[model samples]
Target: MSASSITSQDLSIGQIFQNFYRVPDYQREYVWSESDAKGERGEEVEQFLKDILSEFEQATKDGAPEYFIGTIVVCPGEDSVFDLIDGQQRSTTSFLTLCALRDLLVELGETVPSTLAGQIAAQDTNWQGETRERMRLDLQYEDASGVLVEYGEGRGKNARREGTRSIRNLANAYDTIREFLSVQFPSDANGLRRFHGYFTNKVKLIRIETPNVSRALKIFETINDRGVGLDAMDLLKNLLFMKAKQSDFGKLKDVWKGVTQAIYDAREKPLRFLRYYLLATYDVDAKLQEEDIYDWLTRNEAQTGHGIDPIGFAERLRQSALAYQNYSRGRNPAGGADHGIYNTRLLGGSAVKTHYILLLSGRHLAPDLFERLTRQIEETMFVWLIAGVASKDYERVIVQAARNLRRATDAATFAKFEQEFLVHQKSLNMQMFRNALLRLHTYDLRKFRLRYLLAKLTRHFDVLAYGEAGRESLSHYMEAKNDIEHILAQGADDDAKLEFGEGADSFELIQRLGNLMLIEASLNRVINNRPYSEKIATYPSSQFLLARCQAAPLTIGVNDRITRAIQKLDPASSWDRSAIDRRQQWIADAALEIWGVPSPNPKATSEFEMLIPSPNP
Candidate 1:
């Protein structure tokens, strides 16, 4: 590191706002959360204001006549401009204080002067210097995007969206400060004059000069340190820089950056950055363990599988990112593509769960079968999608499902699950699948790596999942109650009986897909009310449900296609043309390895079990 001394004058809220100081183009967007620093903005703001107010109150009580809220930073900056590296928050709050003062003065019918210290109310002769000059009535301000904008009656107009917009909750802090200002100065002309004296004459801003941008950037990083936190983009950015050829790096970076920027700019926060990252890079299949995926990201364990060199992995990421970008932009690869990952929020709903479901559907089964399973899983978990979910439990299910599949004893066990899945219909299978995942997620989130849990909790997935208001509610809920009920319960009046207790009369009333469909819903109401075998045999809608699922998209992997198809066939009836066609094609395709011959030749039948497990066995 090169050493150079840069001098910049301490600047006030007015100065910073006048220039609209922003994170530099090269700087990462604001990734800090107070929680990341082990602090709460509400508590921090409350204490900060209380301290300032206490100082002011004591100063007045002591009859010292005056005190000001002022602080100076000695750091680096460019010639005439300096970054507010040290005092951004304080400076912002103070500016807000001034705004509140301006609002109050206007309400009070004061004849304000058109200059600093005199803008809201006339400046006193006692306050005649830099504060006076800087606080002038017509001071313009900058925005978070570093755009120089005018600030007059509409200072809040067209404010650029950035990460700190959420911190605007601190506006409550401004409201409190304003109330104190109003209380300190009485309403009468003489008393109001006293208030003006305290505000204009008592509020002083000090300036320190700084000399270079680089030094200022470092100093800013130090004083307002948001030390190492998991920024998903950082890894991707590093990968792009390190792996992309000099020739393609710029284009690749631009594409990746553009996608992230579009998300953040549209969403107006950095959380979307994380959302896009997961959608673009994270792929989870039933055969892949969640812990394995997490390990892939953090420990580079899974990345080592398939002998995937860093260069090769980076190439794949680049391809995937490009594919995602195209899908995001509505450009089809061959005419159609899946943007389900990008469009679905990660919250309580099973988008991530569905992702794994779909992944497994595709990975273990052929593309056609995978699509079918995906549709079934989605329709079954429709309620989860609509009701929204608490995230911790949501991820637990996601990770565990992958873990379970990765541990499968052999293709047969995997085939058995697939056979059961098709026999029962995708909806019923998915309901059970999600229940399994939820149980796992709950266990994993609490007991797994604390570091990973923390990162998962802090991730940007929520921005897409819960959204702003929902995010707030979720935070409040988490802070207040550590757990969220995964199952939506039946109303008290419901008469249906259940294993645990009285259940909802209708599936609509139940939340858990497992409880609602497989056991409790009207579709399975008879089954749950009766014995399992009787219900499966006599249920009026069972065959219709399976037929409907068969028509839907296939979502299992290439390997599972034969198994899925065979599971759908009737052992007693003459094999239909579709089944025969599928069997014939299966034999010809090189993709089918577990079974060489697809026909019912005795040898083929024996070998078929290797590829497709019996639903009963």
Candidate 2:
């Protein structure tokens, strides 16, 4: 291999595009937009334009020095061409701005600079067909290419078509440039000329050229080391491609493209998925950091007698990506009733990523065993979260659990694995879990957390009391919009205060989980702060356990714990502090049953030791 040569030089807009620049097929599309989804001016694009226009205005009186726009890194290719490694967004947007200026010059009957007009489209026989006019800045994807070609020809439209986000964004950028120029110059040709000269000459970029793609990408990483400007996954992808033999590049690229498309909605999917993949596939320790994943994979591949080939590794990544995607979307790759239920109930929350890593690592297990393990993980996480376990503690426990679970070879091993690792480290067991629930002030939790608790209760109530026939799927309640209502209203008026008794500590009771119910948000406003009699009258209309508060005879059901408790509470009685206390105790008991914690086994020893020193010590 030839030694890689690196050179950096300041380049103006005109000088940068003088040579052919091609965005490789593996590159992401033109994702720059004029405005965000909210119709607000895009931060990056607006800043770029403002900076350039301000520089142009200043140059009219005092000649401005070169304004540093950003950096561009490219690899020298065959026949004086270059493959763009970074700075595509900046280059593409600049090209669009030039095209807009060229068109405006022609529209005003001013002599358009031939060099400026020539930058829009270049005639190249190197293009597959007979000599054809192509955009100077060629994009990888069809939608962006089409928009670029149309815009370069002065026929671009602002209306979005049924296409990818890139296409819409391309069109939006062109329109943005045109509108910006028109608004800044109005009908003055002199202002347009002045702006054009400054944009072409003053705006600058540090062009870094390397002899090979690998070297260029290294420079790309070095330049973006301080920020997430370059995704870690993108760097890993380039590394994998660089490692593969030239003969296998096409095959490896195809496999990688398929894997990326499968998880396109997941931003930085490779970084996350690959970490879990390595943790599960190898016998790594519990502290497997995400940043070390690439180096770990490389070291593992270099090991004697256990090396993974590039193509085989890529294929495994493809398969694992699909499984990871399924788990992320709460779909069961291994179809079963329990698997479905576990995924549906536990998959949509803040702690979902922890579960995803565990599930992804154990995806190869039998459906039944996988379901059992899923429940174990969910239960473990529930205890940890409710106990307010420190983040570091939770991560340590979960990572260790993932390592142990991934190493399990069969159902027996899996069962034993749970027994060993699922024990509470510090304050994270049934006793602590129960205490946490009893002391949990619902209002103290963020709205989403409170809603999650109520949603879980709603699901548990349906299964325990209603059975299959009267079962109302609280999946919607869990996943959708549901209001958390205070049974004893937060701002109870004088009438409601008198009904509940005057001396009652309404504030203390109002925040308690026992005093809360999940009702449709639409009904909360209507039933707000009513007397206990009126509130109980509205209960029968609800699908949740709140409806069981009606005077009708309680239905005979299997696990009627919560429903029976509600049945015992008299609607005619004042909903005072005493009522709140009774309901709070009932809720604490139900929570224990809902999120079951394993009892200590005589044969098992604690696998995890808490880092915190005991108070007695």
Candidate 3:
């Protein structure tokens, strides 16, 4: 944190738009709902209109009553622009309102206000340095694709509806406002004009401007505290306490404390753990969102056995939370890192923990069988993750697998479930996995995922050459002080561009899996953007086999596997686009085996009831 400067000013909606505002790339998409909106989502757009109109109606003829539309936090940027941090929902909605009013005035054959047009869009420079009129509410996120500009300028009729989430939501918000305004004012141009005047002037908002986005967010957090999960967990616990007799309060308290402690120790959200426990252990027909848990629990108390045996439910949670703590830390019951726990934890994306909904359900399985199950689950799951399959399909099947595990009495019963699990992934074979890897570009991946993918590929090859010692040597990029080397440099110079030029596609080609390798950062700094002919000497000493094999006469831990792996490449020859393709093909083959889900046995098919559930959506 740095020494920060802050200022607050009360401004009307119209005056607020005087200074340029931009939604940064890091900010989330416009997700406000028109209907089914509650709490923080403005309780439906109609409520926003009704409330403001109500405030306006309360005027005593002396002056119109000012309606405070809440506060916005922003950080100042160059050219009098402010990088909007908090309150984009309100600001974006207000901009849409202005656009709607302008359109209404035009539709009613009245003169459109030039000031209103300025509020919607102003002069700006495109990335190519060409001057153009871009929307005032510029959504800089990749998925937005200038949706705000298209809609705000009345050019959205021909715009694509099946766009990304942000585009769809922005369009919906604009239409919702436009429709609401039309219905409210009917065809009266005067009523629309008066409302627009009142909206631009009377609807006031407070702006908290800070020096930077981080500091602005820090101040925003100070003003507003977050405890949604904690509050829900507390409420659930109190409900249990209220139901229990006074004599059992102490016992219940002990159970609750153990549950919370296990979760806290595991550094997991307590509510998520509890919710997952229910989903894993039983058949939950409904998609159990966090907010829906309380009502669901209260309504189905006796059917689920939680109401009659609060203590028993608490005990189950306490036990599962402890096991979950182990799983979260990539550990088995013996506190070891085997059973692919580390690999499971390393998988990228938010839904990674959903597997626990099954893992905890099968806690009673024998240790060796449990390890096999973990491996099976991760192997199938990782393939799905890499293939960009929707998680909803995976989660539903995982829930059913957990229940099937609960019904398992022996190794054969568990083995039957595993067979079905493999059979279910019949579509996710080597062909699909290889094709998915073919499209992989490291630049498209998140930071952690990119590292995980490279590190994983490096580790697998390294282990084959260097054995167990290879795992110990990884300091990311599979060695200490190494960087993810673009074997073909990212330089945009004419010679660099012509190296593997596919015209416009050449730029993206450089980021593909084939063009990248792991090299020592020290060596990399020297030959960072150098020609392949100049950079090959440094590869001989590189820790990564993937890079080391590229150079000739490899002597460090040389083996048949390393030799066979690099059979096609000739270090004496020049590296170019063709070389990148061959290297990527090698990586793609490795990926198929790494993420392969084994085929089901011919005889094992139809030997038992198929327990894998069909995906709901």
Candidate 4:
């Protein structure tokens, strides 16, 4: 052996990065700080700063140079480089902090220390007498492979958004660190300089280096649960190693890395992944919680086949993670656009992530069958939301259905699963769906549900009518600023009332599902206050086909979907009460089909269809 056991050195943040790091592809992504829709920052990232700032204050008063943060385990590698086995998250944050400090110091007009820039990336003449440099942290993982270098080169903001969760987290962490620095220093340049000095020189962590990856991983498993502890993900990895034989550690670690990286790339949580895996593989109906994930896995190791074949289980998990990543990115097994998979994300990024249980349950099925399952799951979720089915009730149905879904390995079985379980006709009443459609307004959960509904509606027609959005992913619609457009202005003018009648002035009419459509926010802002006559012309400018369908000339295609729905709408028909009813009725008819709700009253369809004029006869 190189030594009796291993070597350890306590080093400050500045000292640790003196040698560059390459985070092996198996490590988790930069997740110490994640920004979600709920406006919550990563608790650990925030706490990282809060705790450090407390130490910074005392260290400043005491003029101390060593305030320990945590530990990092690594395997020594070629040429002053190290393969980071543990503490990539903390190390990545340290690298980012260097970037933020330099950027913020420049923004605040403080002289950046020569050492700070050198820590991020060293500049020196090589043996050939030419200048060469490299970033201190090199992330070799997919998803955000080149992002660290981009930050090092001072182009962090320009990092592309390909729906890569790691890039988003990295960008968010940089901004968060910059913000923390600004808040702590305010207008005092001297205070800012002092804080930077303390951060680089005082913030310390223990670096553990081993001769090999296996040794480093073992060392990591030992101390990771203590002091700025590792997340459930790390502990689970340790659990996998514990159950496997010595000869299989490398294989187990390889698959485990793929499992974790896939989940991280998808922007999903590891514990969430573990919980869903348990459900899809073992107890789909058990009220498993995320916090209880490790405990559940340990208890059910034998039942889940993990104890029998831990390597095989990891392989299965790797497959599930790959599927989860595809579903997260809105791709089907065949790598084609699956609206069913896309709509869940378009519904709500993380809120509707549980919808993946169905995806995971039937992943081993044929591509067409898997596609059918996703579509059915998407429809079931919509119906549940529309029928005002309680979340717990919806969860119950999907969870139990997922257990049976794994058995639906063929077309016939999938059809049976769809009919017996996914079809929610009995639970969702036609009239209930109709009234729910009428009652739809921006309130309660409706804010997100309404966006999801409108986005789906626009996407459905866009694909059906023109076949244009076929090339555009749901992300284009999702990332783009979308607004819930009100056709009738809320503050009714005299012209609006006279053109549409007295009831058109009512807030209820203005907020109705029929009157509302999805439009790009920029377009909405321009026409938002205009009257129907003035706004109808600008509807053609909207990115949304639904919004553009107001006038006949807005479209040129003779596609039968829109033509039969309304054979070239008249350019002269102003936005009016009759139009709102017709639009609402159109949506109600589609809603029944989309969500698989029971048919509306037969007479009602006839009454609604009459609003669309007949062809010359």
CA RMSD of each candidate after superposition: 15.7, 5.0, 19.0, 10.0
lDDT of 3 by residue, 1-617 (tens): 23577888999998898778888664545656522222222234556777888987776657898999888888876555788877777888888788878888887899977778877777876567878776677677565777787667776554555567566666666667777888878998988888887888899999998887556656554544332322446556645654666577668867876787688667676678878888877777527776666666767777666667888887887888889989887776556655466566666444478888778887888888888877777676666666665667767767766777788768999888876664456333434556667777876566566666777777766676656653742335534576787777777445555654553136677788887776678878877676666677777777667677775746434557666545533343466677777778877777756555444444544422333322210
> After aligning candidate 4 to the native by TM-score, how far in Å is the CA of 135 from where it should be?
15
Query: What lDDT does candidate 4 reach at residue 361?
Result: 81
Q: After superposition, how far is residue 283 of candidate 1 from its true place, in Å?
A: 17
Residue 181 in candidate 2 has what lDDT?
A: 89
> Clashing residue pairs in candidate 2, if any?
none
Report the candidate with higher TM-score, 1 versus 2.
2
Candidate 2 per-residue lDDT, tens place, 1-617, comes to: 25766888998887886777877766666666734435664556656798887767666465776788899998877545788888988998898898888878777889987777776777777645567666677776544545566777877553454476577677777777888889998877777877887888888888998888878867876776533565556656666666666577668767877677566544334566666666555666657676665556556665311233667777777777877666665555643334333433443353446556677778878877777776666666666666655556665666666667777889789878766765443233556566667867865566666676677766676665556453433457755456787877888777777788854445766888877778876667777888776776666677765444533435566455655645543332457777777767776677766666655455557566543321110
Q: Candidate 2 at residue 32, lDDT?
A: 68
Indicate which candidate wins on lDDT: 4
- Candidates 2 and 3 compared: the better one by TM-score is 2
Go through the candidates in order and give each one's C-alpha lDDT: 0.36, 0.67, 0.69, 0.71
TM-score of each: 0.40, 0.81, 0.56, 0.62
lDDT against true structure, model 1? 0.36
Tens digits of lDDT, candidate 4, 1-617: 39436889988787887887898765656776777546576776767888888877776464764577788888876555798988888788878877877777777777778887888998646557777798888887775758888788767557553466688788778778878887887766777677777888789899888887777767876785432276566767765665678688667867887887787677777778877777877764457666666666666666777776888888988888888888888887556778778876666545677677777788788877877777777776666556566565556656777778788877888887776666533233456556667556555344656777877767766666667545345555554588777878786667766777758767777887778777888888888667788887788887666677666545454766755434423333677777787777777777776566655333322111111111110
- Candidate 1 residue lDDT tens string, 1-617: 22565544443333434432322233233222232222343454445455555545555544534444444443333322334434444555555555555556666787543443334222223323332222222211112332112122324323333334333333344545556666755454444444444444555555443454434434443332222222344443443333445455445544555544444333322333233334323443323332233334544436333123444554454443443334333222222433223222222221243343224323334434433433334332322332233334333344434344333345556565443332233222233323332322223332212122222222222332224443332223223222221122333222223422423343432332222111113343333444222333433343222211222322455555433553442221112223333422322231112111122222212111112111210
Report lDDT (Cα) of residue 364, candidate 1.
39
lDDT over C-alpha atoms for residue 145 of model 4? 57
Top candidate, metric TM-score: 2
Candidate 2 lDDT score at position 153: 80
Cα RMSD of predicted structure 4: 10.0
Better of 2 and 4 by lDDT: 4
